[model samples]
Target: MTVYVDNARIPARVGRTSGRWSHLTADTVDELNAFAAELGLLPGWFQTCKRKCHSTLPCVHWHYDVTDKYRSAAIELGAQPIDIREMGALTTARRAALSARPKGPTP
Candidate 1:
C-alpha cells in the first residue's frame, strides 16, 4: 500500500482555529497510521468513522488532516502527491480494504 498526500489546501477549522489543510491517506489504514507516526502525529489525529451522525452506518475513512507545514514534511518524506481524483480513488480503495477484513463478534 502506498501513502499519498493531496494538494487540496481547503479552508477548514480545526478546533477554534481555521486554516488551509491537506489530506494524507493510503490504500490501507495500517500504512496511513504508520506513515503518520513518522511525522510525529498522534494516533488520535487519525480520521475514522464519525461518532455522531444522522446515519447509523459508519463511513470508515482512514486518513489524517494535515496542515501546510505537515504537508511539506509529508512530501519530503516520500508521500506521493495526488489530486482530488486520485484522493477519491485512494479513499475508495481504503473503504474496500476495510470491507474485506474479517469481522469480529459484535459487542
Candidate 2:
C-alpha cells in the first residue's frame, strides 16, 4: 500500500492517490486492538487477512484509505515503515485458480 503521511486527518478520497491493501505489523490481537483503538478505530473493523510472510506477528489487512491513515499514525507511534503491494496479478491469478479447482477430490 502507498502510505500517505500528513499532520492532519485526510478529508477526502482521490483517485490515483489512493493506495492498495497492505499487510500490518502488530503480531498479537492485543497489539492490533491497542494500535487501532489508539487511532479511534474500533476493534471489530480490524480485519484478519493473509500475509505473504509466515510469522506470529499479528498481520492485518486494511483497505487503502485505512492503510494510508493508519500507516501515518504508526510512524508517529514509533512503528517501522514498510513498502509493499499485495500484487494485483497474484490476487487475480489465485482467484482464477481457485475457481477452476474442484470442490472435492475427483473419484
Candidate 3:
C-alpha cells in the first residue's frame, strides 16, 4: 500500500500495522509533525532520539506509526502508500554503496 505523509510517499501493509512511517530527520521533524497534526494523528505517533553512528548525529526521525485500519484516514488527507518490496531495494542499494567504500588501501 502507498501512503503519502507530508506529501512524501512511503510503505504500508506487511506486519502488525499495515503502514510503516518513513524516517524524518530532525530538520524535517517539525514539518512532518505539522503535517501529521493536519492528518489528525495522535502525538504518540511522534518519536525523538539521536541514534549514534560514526560518532555523528544525523537529525532525529519522526513517525506516525499508523496501521492498515487508519490508513484510509491518512489517505483522506493525502498520504500515498507504497510497496514494501520497492522500499527494500532502496536499502539494498544503500548497503551496497556503504560496502563499496575504500578502507585506507588495505595492505
lDDT per model, in order?
Answer: 0.81, 0.46, 0.49
Give the total clashing residue pairs for model 1: 0
Model 3 stretches astray by more than 4 angstroms:
1-27, 48-50, 53-55, 59-61, 85-107
Candidate 3 on 1-107: residue-level lDDT in tens?
A: 23343323356654565554453211245655676677676677676444743333332233555554455566675555545454344345444555576756777
Best by lDDT: 1
Model 1 misplaced stretches (Cα beyond 4 Å): 51-60, 96-107
Better of 1 and 2 by TM-score: 1
Ranked candidates, highest TM-score first: 1, 3, 2
My TM-score estimates for the predictions, one after another, are 0.74, 0.41, 0.45
Across 26-92, the per-residue lDDT of candidate 2 in tens digits comes to 4344665666576666555555456642333332333223556566666776554544333333334
Clashing pairs in 2: 27-57, 27-58
Q: Comparing candidate 1 with candidate 2, which one achieves the higher lDDT?
A: 1
Which number leads on TM-score?
A: 1
- Sorted on lDDT, best first, the list reads 1, 3, 2
Winner by TM-score between candidate 3 and candidate 2 = 3
Native-referenced Cα lDDT, model 3: 0.49
